[model samples]
Target: MEELFNLTYKDEVEILKDEDDFEALGDEKYLNHPDMEARLYWAFCRPNGSCEAQIKDIDPLVSIMAFNHSKLNALKRFTLLHKEVIENPNLRVKIKNRTRMLFRSLVDDDFKELNKVLDIVPVFLEVAVDQLKNGRKWNDIFADEIEATIFMQKAEKFIDDSFKEALFFKLKDLRELDQEELKEHLEEIIEKKEKIHTLILKHYKNEVDKWIEKSNLHLLQKMTIKKLAEKLI
Candidate 1:
């Protein structure tokens, strides 16, 4: 029994060490050790020219860093790095180079590390979907429709079914609403149809119509949240 337990313990430790090795390589290869700037650059860049791209690109490195260190200083360093990028446009070339190096390292140094990066994809996807439901701009929600669809496709990976269902229901509610009734509700909310409320209702109606035409339930839900937020603004 003792030998059996020892063997099991050894196997567990080996598994953990393998995980650590993957994480450490990610930190070195992608994050650019001792240089937070490089890390932030890698985190923010997107295939398209936009800073608002979901941090999903760098989430793997970030998650590994968080797991290894779990320290406030590390978190602060990352935050500052992101802030610096936000403040400086001149660093774009340098950042892009770092991203290239990081990608190269994965291909040339340790191909297995590439799998580690993909491991956190589901988690990042969950974050992106949650952001959309929490009222982020439609375009700002996910990196693209592909990412969103990937998340939806892997619904079993989601931990919070209630939240997901709530978002779905919210969208469904919007899609099912009577356009005439929505117009009346808008008038009641703003106390006049000739005011900004009328314009808002018109926009909402158009957006809903577009969603219906496209049969994009997720987008319809997001538009519903946007319409609700406009009422407060």
Candidate 2:
């Protein structure tokens, strides 16, 4: 079961060898003792460190690090995970499910910590597109219509125009499913896709309006905006 492989904060701490034991001494003392924690953090973070070599599978570790205890810590871990995922083909394969799960969590959480590391959003978006292209289930990609619409509102700016087009096209394809398949929570999928489509269009229109206002063009500006919409959508 996936739960068997899932790691919690406690599970991650235990993997630090003596972290749990050290923490049991006292919360204050454990918090003050940075040397040991620093060493362990580095051990786990470093690409060539012993921890990396010892852990044959990094899926759970990556998942835990993605949504770490604090925004700052998660930002740091995300930077390292991004590097590893980009540099190591093996890591990319191992991290696929966990990465999708991270996206789902971010959506469900309304992207609370995403502003801390906006640059990393693109990689998550890329992973999402990869999953969709590989025929991953809709539920695996998003929590539900409400959570997904929140994502469209908050995280849509980070999504590239091409990615939006691909997502829209795919969602449209999903909508075309027959009535037989519609019985299985397909309506939720339909609602999610429709909301996302509308949000994207609204974003595009708002962007064009802002551009037009900034450029201070008259009738010709409207023509330029039309061209821009043609290119963007």
Candidate 3:
């Protein structure tokens, strides 16, 4: 799956290359979904801008970059737009060349890494959605599976490929399994190797609306998150 922005599981990324591409993706019904419409609005409408110039005068490259920027949660987009450059330094230079003042005003930093903004959104999103402030990290859960897999792998005669798959996915809970001796052995491995998730939740923003209100965050970071939040909230 290759979703362009935040979504990781889409089968093919739908790139809005131009007016025609946007028209194809959008409809009256499409507007019903807040996120889709927000993406479209930020990407095309650019509610922040007040330009009335002719389409021919606007650089096409700027539109593409802006839309790509829109894919990031608004606040995060702002972060990368200023704090980090695009995957390419050239694209940042190109956008700066075209837009000139708007971006220059928002973020003046020269650093850029594609998806620098995107990476932070999910960290907050999971904390908010799942309320995972005090819990095991998912990677550690997967590590338990790894421990079990290594132990089981030694017994090639008994453990089949399907069993290995289930073990990896934790499709069935190992804790309740009937094999007590193997379970104890696996539990011991987990005890020694497992890492704990953090107790402190860095994201104190209870409402998505409040994410931008925190003063400790960089201004560009707040700007990026705030813009995306505006569309949905």
Q: Which candidate leads in TM-score?
A: 2
Descending-TM-score candidate ranking: 2, 1, 3
* lDDT tens digits, residue span 111-164, model 3: 021123224322222222111222222332333323333333333344445433
Q: Residue by residue across 25-62, what tens digits does model 2's lDDT show?
A: 33332222334443334334432232222222244333
RMSD of 3: 23.8
Per-candidate Cα lDDT values, in order, are 0.37, 0.42, 0.33
Model 1 weakest lDDT span, ten residues long: 139-148
- Score candidate 1 by TM-score against the native: 0.22
Q: For this target, which candidate reaches the highest lDDT against the unseen true structure?
A: 2
Clashing pairs in 3: 74-224, 75-224, 75-225, 84-111, 84-112, 85-111, 85-112
Candidate 2, pairs of clashing residues: none
Residue 147 of model 1, lDDT score: 28
In model 2, state the lDDT of residue 30.
25
